[model samples]
Target chain A: SAVISQKPSRDICQRGTSLTIQCQVDSQVTMMFWYRQQPGQSLTLIATANQGSEATYESGFVIDKFPISRPNLTFSTLTVSNMSPEDSSIYLCSAPLWGTDTQYFGPGTRLTVL
Target chain B: QKEVEQDPGPLSVPEGAIVSLNCTYSNSAFQYFMWYRQYSRKGPELLMYTYSSGNKEDGRFTAQVDKSSKYISLFIRDSQPSDSATYLCAMSAMTSYDKVIFGPGTSLSVIP
Candidate 1:
């Protein structure tokens, strides 16, 4: 297991504003992923943050709405742009540790777009 | 249908009671199965993991995987009030490490 940390543990933002959440891993990871968990809902994959390349987003999500950056193997950032109340959810970052089948998650950012 | 399905259980049980949690998956290609426990206002912590099929036991928790039925289960013996949390099941294929799919969590409350 790796030590994963996320910044801005909880934030209340106005609609139409943007919030950036940062993820840092204690050790380098092979792949990084962003996920969203709505209230009383299952988690949904938002995108895969690839180092030195554009993030690969899942269906119903686009880069313009949730742009991500992975400048290095140990760090990544996700920005929720033009937020809405519907975007009120917990955002998390996770990555697979080397030679392991399990993926570890950060504490997550609780964003409330009011 | 979703790739993984789990009952959104707010199951309440007394302390020392045996607890059962389960998940079913539609994708047979998934090779790695995992169970995670998430407390309120916290990220999920990996509790149990198994590859292929069979049962793995650690401490008071037992994880069972039945690939033939595309089902999996987690059993906790002597449940504690501190064990109350949302339990999530996750899986991944051999194809990539970034495509792990998570099921809807089951909320459990073990009252003392």
Candidate 2:
């Protein structure tokens, strides 16, 4: 198991503003992921962040809207640009346990766009 | 049909009762099955994970996978109030780094 933490545990942002959520892991990992989950809904993968390379985004998400930065193995960031009401959801970061199929998640950053 | 489908049940059960949650998927390519527990305003925590078929038990939680039917289940024995949360079933075709498909999640409430 790994201890993961996210910054700005909860934030309220204005429309058209941008917010960056940070994810820090206790141990170095090969891959980190960003996810968006609406209240009472399932989780949706936004992108895959790998160190030293561009983040691989899912079909509906784009870099222009959700830019990811993986500066190191233990840390990454996800920025929601030009925020709208639709972007008001819980943003979570997760990393899989090394050599195991289990993945651990951060506490999640709850973003509320006004 | 959705790739993954869950009951989405706000199931309420009495403490000490057995609780069962289920999910069905259309993707036979999925080989990894997992159960996650998510409390309100919290990230999901992996409760049980099983590869391929058969059953795996962790404490009071049992996870079962039947590839032929493309269905999976999570059972909790002697449920407690602390177990109240939304249960989500997740699956992946390859490694953990691969894209994981998640179910709609079923909300469970173990009343005291």
Candidate 3:
């Protein structure tokens, strides 16, 4: 299992403002992903942060809204752009360790958009 | 229909009781099954990982997967008050590491 950490354990912001969340893995991982979770709800995949390439986003999510940067294998950042009350959710990052079927997650950044 | 379905339970049980959590899926293609536990204000922590069918036991936790019925379960023996948390069921098709899907999760509280 990899130790994953995210910055700004939580934050509160006004609607239309943007916030960026960072994910850092203790070890190098080949796959890094960003996820969003509403309070008392399931997690939704936002995008796959590819190393040195463009991020792959899931349906219902767009790059312009959740731009991701993967400069290396151990670090990635997800920026929630032009936030809305609907965007109030816990942002998480996860990575599957090499040669393993399990994915480990960061503590998460809880964003509250008022 | 949702790919995966789980009872959003706030099931309360006394400490030391056996707790059963379950999930059913519509997709038979899902090969990797996982159970995750999330405490308040924390991320989902992987508690059990099973591939295909059969039961895997570790300490007080036992994970059972029944591919024939498209159902999976997690049983916690001697449940503790610290076990109070939300449990999520997740799976992936074939060997795709990124094709994972998650259930809404069940909230369990083991009271002392």
Specify the highest-TM-score model's number.
Answer: 2
Fnat values, candidates in order: 0.66, 0.73, 0.66
Clashing pairs in 1: none
Once fitted onto the true fold, the runs of candidate 2 whose alpha carbons sit more than 4 angstroms away are none
Q: What TM-score does the predicted chain A of each candidate obtain versus native chain A?
A: 0.97, 0.97, 0.95
Q: Compose the digit string of candidate 2's lDDT tens values, residues A31-100.
A: 9999999877899999999999999999999999999999999999999999999999999999986766
In candidate 3, what are the lDDT values of residues B34-108, reduced to their tens digit?
999999999999999998999999999999999999999999999999999999999988553577899999999
**Model 3 stretches astray by more than 4 angstroms:** none
User: Which ten contiguous residues of candidate 3 chain B have the minimum total lDDT?
Assistant: B91-100
Q: After superposition, how far is residue B104 of candidate 3 from its true place, in Å?
A: 0.6
Q: What is the CAPRI rating of model 1's predicted complex?
A: medium
lDDT of 1: 0.92
Identify the candidate with maximal DockQ.
Answer: 2
Return the lDDT, model 1, position B56: 98
Output the lDDT of residue B63, model 1: 97
lDDT of each: 0.92, 0.94, 0.92
- Which residue pairs collide in model 3, if any? none
Number of the top-ranking candidate, with lDDT as the measure:
2
